[model samples]
Target: MATELNKGPMLGQRHVQSFLLFSAITVNFMTKFNAGVAVVAMTDAESTNPDFPEYDWDEMQRSYILSSFFWGYILTQFLGGWLCRRYGARITMFASTLGSAVLVALVPWCVSWGGWQAYCALRMAMGLFQGFVFPCIHAHLANWCPVNERNRLGALANMGIDCGTLVSMFASGLIAASSIGWPGIFYVSSGVGIFWCIMWWFFGADTPGESKLISEAERSYIENSISSSHKAKEGHAGTSIPVPWKAIWTSVPFWAYMITKCCQSWGFSTLQTEMPAYMNGVLLMDMKKNALYSALPYFASWVMAVVYLIIADILLTRNIMSITGIRKTINSIAFFVPAAALIGVGFLDSEQKTLAVVLMCTNVGINAGSTIGSTINTIDLSPNHAGILMGIANTASNVIPIVTPLLVGIMVKDNHDRQQWQVVFIISAVIFVVGDLIYLAFGQMVTQPWDAPDFLDKERSPNLQEEGYSKALEAKESTNVDEAKRKEIEAGLESEEPKKKALNDEL
Candidate 1:
């Protein structure tokens, strides 16, 4: 095994993959959130942009358009994971982006052909194509990220969600206000998505071993840091490794994670899909103003996500907390703090616009910490099946996006009514808190028995298993020895004490 004595450049193929993942996520979300901003400009009953045609639609109809994407989104969550595991992330993500880009490019023509109904169909189709993105990315990262670097690398890749949302919200308004008008939104977004697809196809690979740009030293370092169970042959057929579906289905920790993911999605979908309506109807902001203001929370979220990543990396590297402890702690803060902020938003009236916006920003910014927690926890529990677990958990969670908008439409029948909005916020707050509590009780970082590839072949590999156990013990001892020497050096730096310090004296 490669030890601390062997080192390689921190920036390598892994970092390149991180950059590509970041770009892909940003473009994916840009397409996703374009509708959020474009709809405002399209149906702005008060707008006087003669070049852009305004649609006659009620809040209910608008809600349907906003919610339509999830119809196809919900269908492929599990399937995407399965396909990603069977094929590879490179192909899955490439196809997802390419298909979504084509649909985006056609949105304007679809609206012209059949109005809202046809446009809704297009969005559903786009969702179907984009559904493979997250599971594929998660599976790809499982192959690339070492356990120690998970928090930083995962946070870096996921930050694209916030950045993409920020750009869409900020740019969509400006684009609609430009001479190009609402159609420009779809056109520009499609161009960006297509550009990303081109880059991905040329530069991206499924794993470090497959990458032409990676160095042998860096590749060896990555392989040594990762656990044995996660190592997959570069071009092996999927039939070689059977998924432990029954074990996964029965895991309590997995269910807890699913609950937390659902709750987060509920809050996120609410903010992402309906915040514009809330700003326009209750806050009485125009489309341009709404777009600018909507961008703020996500900007704050992206910045705070960086802070969370830094802090999480520090805690892990310094041994300040156990892996499970860090995940639980960060997750609690992510959920509970956001819940409080959402509850606070409910009580703020239009008269307190600044306060309301600040609270909303606070909710999203703090919630970004979830990237380090439930988002990356899939790999912690079972690296081999990270893709499948992502599918299961995300598939369950995405149902929230479908239901949230409908429920919001019902609860806030009068979109301008602040009291009704309060009820929505309170409901979201409750879900967030409940989900965290369940995770605290059952979520874990330990690898499960089902994660093992050949647990059932005990009789055939008893001697091999024994040999592996002995090697693991040797590695553990080597690690302990290095840790002891480091502590001794630290003790020497502190004021020299005549008495020898005990093992328990150090952190």
Candidate 2:
């Protein structure tokens, strides 16, 4: 039997999972983006604060370093989804985080052994280990979060990205400025990742049922609120369902999501990895101030992400707008606004440093609205296959991370050249607009037919639609019979009434 929903507090074991996931993500991104900051610290020739010698790495080598991680990142995306489906989200996420932590801890040693080559190798390994993060999170959230809470919870979890970037930017600068130098950034980040893994292992579970910590009422409410087909019932071990690869591949809305995600990734990747470098190379900012500048945009992004989440939830809960309308509107703001901001950034000169910082802040801050748009759409499209769908979409989109840095590296042969930087921003803005247009045209928020566990079987069975029609016909006939009986009773009453009137006249 379906459990009735309580009208009170929504927090419980599920929220714990969200918080654990958030911590893990924060650590994950902290380690992932440590390189973004460390590279700036490592390469900045003008910085006198470093205790260790700075590398004379040019634009191309740094690009190579930044892009190498995605090579391994892209390799494991599909596998991550598969693992999430087979082993459950808890184990996959655990493995990803733990392995990434171990690899991150080893990065300094690896760099000592092989210089840039070793650094790139270690970064790739880190990506390989961490590639499962998104698919696993999607899979986990699918089980734990009810439809009504999906937007708010998912956005909250992803806010870790902003927080992580902020910390990495701010901390890396101060640490690099200290006697510990550039390597301290990696050590501190790795330590945090390791700590988060320990917490996750103890507190995290794949589903509410698996969790010993969740109250029975909340567990029942969660199970009953989400689609029953997606959850395993009592006394039964959950089994993996087959993926509808064909339908997913053919899905128009999914492709729109893919395109938009790729566009966002490009802009995000370019800004995240390159922004600190831009601050150092173009604006001639010191390492500490560079970190502060890099951190500010992410802080704003985090704040706006929460704002978008609140608005989204209100619109959804109150029926103020349809899901599709809200998604499109929020997504448009995310893309179009950022697109304009980036153009403004491209046009700014060195004298306009303050204006440039503001534009950069606006670019990332508004992009946070996408947390409500494309980020949660996988669940909307297919609650059952959310993980796999996310994997497929992310796989298609992850190509951007590989391409963006390399392209930026090539284009900005001289990092100090503002014209080259302007071209990069304009190109990114164009991609963002193009992606937004595609999403507006083809994006859908409703569940697709291919989301069913039996969708493949139904496709193979030629008589399925016919069988549905037959059932409908039977129901229609039954309704017709009842209607005919009702009419006959009305006719009998009418005839009796007329006869009674005639008898009264005769008397």
Candidate 3:
């Protein structure tokens, strides 16, 4: 019976297992960086091989090819969020992971077919599948991990970037530099993705309570924590506004989250896609060395974020700090660190290449704050409704990729000038500082609907008023015992029809 009971809803121990499983899947799903990891290895071949050999290639053309993924990613955010809300996280993850795998497998063909055009089309398709991955992951984690444990668990999934980055840089670099040509790198990475897809197909569940193998003790613990939420027996939890729209559109917290997300992405995306090329062009890094420098900043960001999340979550759940207070302090620390590093990046001009790399590493590390401000806070705002919030924010912020490519295109003087690259850094630094200010001033971690006067607690059965009338009782709004009694009397008196005496009988 206990085994049978665990498989019904979002609050079971099996749900916890499902969350853990998706973390692994998510990490595997995002490592689709053939552009960054395999590029240097393939470039010479692409330039020389008869099929794609000898095209006029430089940093600008290379950047455009890489930026193509964002176009597909941003386009899918809205639809993906809605689908995750409607279909369930497991289905979306299963589909997205498989979709990306198919697209990745097509990369070598793109190289052989139309070259850059083929590469661009396949990358856009990769982006489409990839867009749904984040929102769907957010939906699962929101339900599977209780609020207090949300960030560490979220960090666990997010730590995929590190895992993926490590594989792409260290693993792929050695492969590219060795006997395997650039295409061999994708062949290896794509295998990891396909394996994860099979695992998800067999094991992934939409919710925890729906898992078959959860222990009773673990299920009881999860139920108790969420008992105050939708898992609660009645009222607010049951009446939860469909989709958490009231808070999402109207609350000050939503914008704060979105701005911080954009700021963080603006800074982080620069490193992931552009930094390698910048090092090659401006700092004079060769291909093999560029892989590590390009890879280091992301490595640092991932580690720092994991440490911050564990410590902060422990403090918040233990009542050592309020959500807003912890958010302000940690985000400030995270922001200032990178902001300071980026401020120095403006000084890079080729002569100070070593100093420039140090500044770049420091600047990139600061963006780890995104996990705290945008990613983790979904739980704080409303655990039940977090997934949709993540979707809305993702859809909004990913525009950075669209805007950034153009910005860099316009700024770089033929892609080699140090001044243009420096300008992009300065601009990123300003966005981060401005975003930090918005979150510090206006963001709140949670919202309560009953705080409004007109809001009816919807969990009451439809017959409450009719039953109250029969019992000669007032509506629930009566303020005190005395008021309740008086209102009851007034209600009874008004409710009764007056008896009429005939006029003829009185005469």
Per-residue lDDT tens digits for candidate 2, residues 267-311, read 888898889888877887877788889999999998999889889
**Residue 313 displacement in candidate 3 (angstroms):** 4.0
Candidate 2 accuracy as lDDT:
0.84
> What are the runs in model 1 whose C-alpha is more than 4 Å off?
1-7, 230-239, 456-507
**Cα lDDT computed for each candidate against the true fold:** 0.84, 0.84, 0.67
Compare candidates 1 and 3 on lDDT and give the better one: 1
The residue pairs in collision within model 1 are none
Which lDDT tens digits does candidate 3 get at residues 277-316? 6776777776567666776776776677677777777887
TM-score, structure 1 vs. true: 0.88
Better of 1 and 2 by TM-score: 2
Q: What C-alpha lDDT, on a 0 to 100 scale, does residue 173 get in candidate 1? A: 82
Better of 1 and 3 by TM-score: 1
Q: Which residue pairs collide in model 3, if any? A: 7-209, 7-210, 8-209, 15-208, 47-54
Candidate 2 — worst ten consecutive residues by lDDT sum? 1-10
lDDT of 3: 0.67
